[model samples]
Target chain A: MAKTPLDEIRSSQVWRSIFRHGYPDTERNRTLAALSNIFLHLHPVRVRKSGLGVRYTWCMGGLTFFLFLVETITGILLMFYYRPTGDAAYNDIAALRDHVPLGVMRELHRWGAHAMVVSVWLHMFRVFLTGSYKPPREFNWCVGVILLVLTLLLSFTGYLLPWDQLAIWAITVGSNMARATPFLGHEGPGASALSVHGLPLIHSSDDARFGLLAGPLVGEGALLRFYVLHCILIPFVASILMAVHFWRVRKDGGISGPM
Target chain B: MLSLLLAEGHGGGLIPAPVRSAIDRLCDPQYFLPLFFVAFVAGLVFYRKWTQPKVAGGIALAALAGFGLALTNHNFLEIVERPDNIPIVGMLGLVAFFTWYSLRLAAVNDERIEKGEGPIEKTGSNDRVLVWPDLVFSEFIALILCTVLLVVWAIAVKAPLEDPANPFKTPNPSKAPWYFLGLQEMLVYYDPWLAGVVLPGLIIVGLCAAPYIDFNPKGNGYYTFKERRFAISAFLFGFLNLWVVMVLIGTFLRGPNWNVFGPFEKWDVHKVVVLNNVNLSEGFWIGWLKTGFPAWFGASPANGSLAQAGNVIARELPGLVLVLLYLAVPPPVLASTVMKGFYKRMGFIRFNLLVFLMLSMMCLPIKMILRWTLNLKYLVAMPEWFLNI
Candidate 1:
């Protein structure tokens, strides 16, 4: 009524159109505020204040999500320079590190990858420690474990992109582990154990690692395949799992508080 | 347009020699970080004792001040020469935050209790804060703080880039990434099939299946280790003793050709420790009978039952018994005694699942100890293709 600055902005046409609600100061507006916003969709209209305790969650889940977002951004920028080829990939990484504008993007992405893994682990640990994964939240916890595995895969695949000695050998060590993966591996259980008329089930030609690398070993083909898995495949799967994870968190009555 | 990446500033400050040297030592990530981590863990125990949050805050502030000062005057170039500095700083920061948070949580609980209330403060949706402004503001604050920290770190320490991909020119200690260092350490005590493949699969499966199997409703939605002693102790043992210990060993103690070098030991390229790995069959024949393989069982000519006899009765007989005893003895013992309550509470299927998980989890440490003391590689190492496990 006095035509104050606060009243002026709230009454403005542009503000009204964009926000749909002014200052979420009332109950109706608070509900509307959560409902109207796109990003806020992840949240319930309210949370138990007990769940808001820093020690309860340790901010691990939030930090993991933040790191993922950082990785997404820095990764997209990296894609602008990276070429998923044996010849060009290593050189591209070197160029990105040395010559590119805001070359620290590479470093950010690298460090972000490491941070995401650690945070995801801690998040799981927090969930377990609190017994938050009990009962109705069991499915969400399983989803979280899947997401954890996906995170590891993402890191493993991304490891080869640098195409350095560290990258190559690490991938070699990691990929070799697949050979002992039960039936899917050439040397794993049930591979040689199951012989239908002297024909082994899984052979060197059709093992999990062979399928992963697209060749006998970690080479150019492996690098290209890993690039696709890292960039396109794993992230997409992780995102879907994460969506369900967050949805379940809300559906299961938000974060676990005092029982 | 090249964004000017600022040259890292790591100048010597106006601090005195002795104090600076002490600060330097206290901040020497290798020593300080581990000690700080242990201190933080101990602090967490005390923190739950309903301490004043202000004390925690004061300590955090002191740590931050000291750490910040160290960062300002510290020789980043020298420290940055090692790739581990990122984790060092990140870990220290997290520990500091954790200490403060733990004490704060204790204080909050104390306050709640003093108000003639329970641990839970449940309010209806009417008392809720708006997700848009209230929640988003805090999240954005966290995100922005993280972004700034990451940016500063990225600018300060350039990501490590080793030589180009060369399969022929392997590193002296061709290490996996830090995350997989635990597995790498396992490779020391186990066959690749076991350590790199089987154990990892089992761990993942066990973790995924944990919540479903675990039906102890005692510690749900609370942080009391007393209520969830088994869960807490098991998790802490696996985490701190197994995973963290292995990773540290892999990262620090493991040197050229994967020898056990001490923290202060220089990694000599030629330092080789000869290890004789014996398969189950070999161990049986050579270890027990003191005879060669083919002649041990008196089966030379190519026959099926003879091979089976050699396998079941000859070589694998004692080993199989030992393995069976190892797996079976623990469950009935646990069921009758210490974990009898868990066995009763978790029911048949879930109880069996839990026991299986626990036994397998116990195997890692048992195997590790055997490796350390007795130089035992695998319990039943056949090395016969898929039957290795």
Candidate 2:
């Protein structure tokens, strides 16, 4: 019988040749070999290398990725029921929690976001403690740091999407807070008559907020902007960076061991 | 406070009525059954890949089946509806049981390994548990404590879901969470752009880049403050100084309308006097320039009736000193000390860089403090010539 593409991909001799390792005799070895395969490349490679245990570092980076995956899955599931319009966004979120078939997705996404921030910080802390950022791994550390910021940005941008009171005010206060950046600050240089070539880009109290929200405070445009950023833009950027982060870890000779 | 507690009791516990309903709804069998089944399946999969794989997997599967049966028979729904505090009690009991079970499991596993009969075969080449026992124990304790505290807090003080957030009725003090108080506090001191965007951006960037910045491998497993004493001290000093300045500004300097606790309510006299007395143009420019002074001289500007002027001087001085120190101190110090002392002291380069980074971090607090001392009204009142970006 002829095989399907997925079946062929799964059972192809070339796939088996490249991926399957060991004698393939023992159950344990077979499991390990399967995990090590290119098809299952998402999992870390098996090695006898050791320094500190999972207890010390708690696999924070991996756990953070796990939480991110959880968020993405749940977030996408949420979009199925959620409407991003001003009139419906808040009500939709409420309905997801109060009326939808699987409302736990919302709570999971919310809690997962908080957990991701924590796990990412701990990951960075663990990396710091292990002195993993030294020499050859310095660039990777920088990339990891940028990933951290993107994670926070993802959370901050997403905070407004639900259109709840907490979401609304938090973003308002957050954006209001953004108005204090030097050039971007509302009271800063470009915010006043003080300008270059007489172009008043940010020349009023509302300018910074206006630019951020794409208008005066959180409105329809702001909702859509935040929705795009949260679901599509930031996550896409984060995933690409995360891929680099993981690949660099391999390039940097795996996780740094204790001195 | 006691009266408030009594009043709250009369109103029906700390948990708001709506939130209680939400909790009740969450505890329903419809919610629990699906969640439990999912967790059971996941746990089974994970267990299957590890020690006693088949047995653990079987038990998890059986548990899931039992739960499903109960759900179908309406038995679980009856248990949920009974409301004899059984759910809470059961959860607590489950937590206690799990704690005991895990400890026993660990002991048994350790005994097995010690007896030369390992609990599970080392299947994968990388399957060796990399986690240190001490770290594991510490984490376990921490997790247990955090869980207990969170559960207790949730039960004790039910957080009232605030009236679904209304945008138009902006609160008098529309602040972020307490963690962000340090930053929000800065809005009182610095330009909103600096407070809101640049400073926070720097801090986040700094935190992210921390592993890269302090790249010495000599201090693994040691606390940062203990191993890299000077660098850590400098960083802490910078963090605390900025935090203090911001908090002070948030607490005292914000206008009367925004004052949450009014200890310095009468101190509006100072604002009135400054508003009435100081020449806006001369003071503003002089103030702006003074921000650059304490860097030249090691001494900070004095505080009191001249606090506004002193603050201006104090804030700018540190920044100026920091810039000069970065440019001048390192190369000269390196040349005189490390270069002269040893031929192969590439380590000194790292040390100097670390010091420079720490010093730069200190500048954040300096900038924050200066901005705080300047107060919001001044920034609002200042003409373009006096304002420095």
Candidate 3:
């Protein structure tokens, strides 16, 4: 048989270097294809037949991670047209919506975020109902719990990016809760008890809420602070935690099944 | 026929005025919350029959149809159509579907176990599949579908952006993000300290502690409600009843000034219900006992004397004592009675931790009842120290 151009490319050194395996038709090549690829390696070379059912797993966890990627891509595009300042934030979003081409990236990011939250909750629920958190998986469950909290915090911080009435007020109501953080908050339970020599230590300007918002109220400072958290800080932390979560899934003997 | 029924006007839809009004009344948090909770529990209790494939599908279809019918009502349509609130609508559908799906699987597994067979998952455990095509291909397809769905959703519904940030004019009934709405609703019954900070903190800790606390080895790695009934029921109660239901209430039912509105009711800016709330101290000292507050209890902190602190504590003596008893007494009593198995399995420290968390979870509902029944504001209110619970 004459060698086709496709076969020639496949036999080429550059192609060979990039893809260590040929077409994953045979069993050995199939295993090599998965084992050699970085992304595909996240899954084991083989899985239990029961674990492959969409009904058995719901695939909510994968959907959540996929949504996170959607958010990240659209979010990066949005950042090109956005500013976190109180002055420009709203106009930037307006511009993105009304002017920029395919600017509905904002909508995608926002909706994807909402979807991610729902998916994460469903993922946790599925894990719980299946007793996937039992015994050896306990520590990973703790890590997953933390990841859930991070996801919420990511969404919460992102809520303030638009700097609209809905954004500010919702954040105001949320961050206001920090003002009542036990002894750390100015108006909390033991605030008065934390006084020294008849002088109170914690106050409005230097309390847990102040630290969160970078000011007494959710204003410019808060907008900037939340922007950093939403864009950089929380995502950074979440990615690391996610790595641990996925690693432990494999380490703890792949997708769980009845023994 | 559908269009005729859905014709909109002053009466909203084909639903008669009296029926709509009755629904409006039923939607009140006082009535709605408990009913939602009871229905959820009943569904779980009767999971076997209800989770049959045909029955579950029928119920799900009926629910969707009813929801479709509700959207014909102008007010309901307005609330549900808001782009930000749309996911919540989607969530209701998704949650219902998953609940049915998971329960159906559990039902199947339970039946198999009863018939001297293994769980469905166990049946094909030895049969392995290749990750290269089987898993990876499915994942790639899922990724493509998800992307297409998101892109279509983005184009169809514009993301919500109201007027720019204005510090002077706060929105009436300002709400937290959808997920935190459960905590926000809790704020109605408890102090921000408890509702916002402490409870959320405890929830994370409790979730993390669940695996350690639960000693059941029967239901490991499979869906079997019969074997893990208590654990499954408790989690559903927390997730569906406490969390998701509260989010739904906050998104749809809560209106201007944080008042509950019916699905068909207008979100009237001027709508007001009598608050007339009183704290426990006032209720104890003046309302019930008909006596004056202790003078030193309200003493100015200008002196900042230790004696004033003592008086403040003394003033809240009744509330303080009751709260102490509530926290301190439950473990031993529960260990000896209802949770005897739990205590035995979890042992001293784990058992106490479990009970403590459970009791803390109960506090939210208990406080909610007190608020509804007595118009009680706080169990322990100390303005001088800015302490309340």
- What tens digits encode model 1's per-residue C-alpha lDDT throughout B174-197? 778777888988776666677888
Q: Tell me how far the alpha carbon of residue B10 in candidate 1 is from the true structure, in angstroms, after superposition.
A: 21
- The segments of candidate 2 whose C-alpha lies over 4 angstroms from its true place after superposition are A1-40, A100-102, A184-186, A190-201, A204-209, B1-166, B177-180, B204-217, B220-227, B231-360, B363-389
Give lDDT per model, in order.
0.72, 0.53, 0.89
Candidate 3: where is the Cα deviation over 4 Å?
B1-11, B295-304
TM-scores of chain A, one for each prediction: 0.92, 0.82, 0.98
Candidate 1's displacement at residue A62, Å, is: 1.5
Q: Is candidate 2 or candidate 3 better by DockQ?
A: 3
Root-mean-square deviation of every model: 6.1, 15.3, 2.1
DockQ of each: 0.51, 0.25, 0.85
Please write out the lDDT profile of model 3 over residues B88-187, one tens digit for every residue: 9999889988898888889989999999898999987988999988998888888888889888999888888899999999889899998999999898
| The 10-residue segment with the lowest total lDDT in model 1 chain B | B1-10
Question: Model 2 over residues B1-389: C-alpha lDDT tens digits?
Answer: 33243333343334345654554454332343245445534432343233243555575577566444333322223322222222232333333233233323334434555676543212132444322222234445655554464345334432222345467876545545322555776554455555667667667566555655564445443222223433333333333345433443343333334443221122232233232322222344456555322333334444332454444445444343544666567655665765543213435654455455555455454543343344323322333422432
lDDT of 3 by residue, A39-143 (tens): 888889999888888888888999988888888888888888899987799999988777877667888899999999999999999999999999789999999
Give the per-residue Cα lDDT of candidate 1 at A105.
90
TM-score of each: 0.83, 0.58, 0.97
lDDT, candidate 2, A89-127, per-residue tens: 877777655665533566556655756665675676556
Q: Candidate 1 docking: what grade?
A: medium
